[model samples]
Target: MVVLKLQSAQFFTAPCEIRSRKRGNGQKFSRIIRCGIAEASGEPAPLGQKTKYNDGPFEKVFMTLFAKKMEKYANSKEQTKKIGWWDFLYDYERFVDASKRVMQGKNRMQQQLVVREVLLSMLPPGAPAQFRKLFPPTKWACEFNASITVPFFQWLVGPSEVVEVEVNGIKQRSGVHIKKCRYLENSGCVGMCVNMCKIPTQDFFTNEFGLPLTMNPNFEDMSCEMIYGQVPPPFEEDPVSKQPCYKDICSMSNPSSSLCPKLLA
Candidate 1:
């Protein structure tokens, strides 16, 4: 008989077991016991256990659009059809790889411009005008926008909820608190998050859509906050732009430099 044990100090719970038995006709029977508490409570699994991500129709639509944009930007001949969770991650990593190649000689502003253009391409025709008309720069508009963002952006940023935040001395539910940013966690590239996602998204909303916005990403926990109707600071003044590489976690990290090399590229 073989027995496997997995214990975690954080989750002090009884061990769940899996048993296999040999039957009379030389056949084998297996019984699997899922962790009931975690499953029922909607909590993450215990330590050392791997979690599988699932994709929905909404996620697939966005992934397809993003992949198409990246494919065009990189001038690749390949077409991406499968937008499953894992496949989407692979495609995102490939886009990052292409960013390095295509943005090698570009300056910081130019790199941001490239990403911003890609973002614009993904949107529908006159989306900015429609968005501006729908959601003006007001507390009620921002709060409604924030509430709807959770469902729309869940695939890219993982689970998130609308949170009340103080903006200009007024409290409003115009903030989205991401439990963990899947883009940051999966890519592990601070530059990619900043240049490819953070800057472009903020600029897209603030400039194109005529709505002020900001994104605060915490590298330590891979969490993030999206605040609508809040003006984002310039790149030179933003602390995120000055953040150094995650040498320990990122595979493409440059330890010798103080900042991520991809920031300029």
Candidate 2:
């Protein structure tokens, strides 16, 4: 088993504010303004052994399941490269690398589609058919979002929070700040970040829930903001959509840009 190198410091993200389109009126999440603790109410599953990072075993199982599902959904050439539960111990971001690898050789568009599809496939049995909807269930959106999505997000990926932001002199929290994004930082592909994670996630939430969302991923620091109740901008108007690969420094970089299907003719 690989010992995880994930440090508590790597988990720290200076929550940044995104210019929100609308000031939220809901105060249901006031207690979680700056910190979100993903408490699972399910019968406590086995977490296996404790890691030096204090990560339990259950999350490892979750990651393995998600990773395997992603690999299965993508049907990439590297089928043998399935991610292991122990990998989370080596580093929480290892799953990101595993995700990118599965989608390797596919275009940004296909990658996006595959991941969105995977999200649905990974849903628990008897999960709502919300993924097939045009908008979130207008009724009880906040309740369901808090009960289901927030905890699942923390389990499936990482701890997320909502920081207080003053909008027009009103201190209201309107979004989730992911201190570390497993998808963006490891993909190392600007187009992948845009198409796979940024665009699809926004569309998925807004369509599945009545609440509109806008996800802004800051490449330099691997931090991201998901503003709820805010409509996302079009492809042309979004800055991350126009970003280029990390000039020769990206893990997936190559001499020819042709490999990046977003630029493909």
TM-score of each: 0.73, 0.61
RMSD of 1: 10.2
What are the candidates' C-alpha RMSDs? 10.2, 14.3
Worst 10 residues of 1 by lDDT: 1-10
- Look at candidate 1 and give me any clashing residue pairs: none
Q: What is the lDDT of residue 16 in candidate 1?
A: 29
Tens-place lDDT per residue, model 2, 49-69, is: 111122334455655666666
Q: Could you tell me the lDDT of residue 246 within candidate 1?
A: 84
Q: How high is the CA lDDT of each candidate model?
A: 0.68, 0.53
Q: Largest lDDT belongs to which candidate? A: 1
Per-residue CA lDDT of candidate 1, range 197-216, in tens?
89988998899988899999
Backbone clashes in candidate 2 total 7
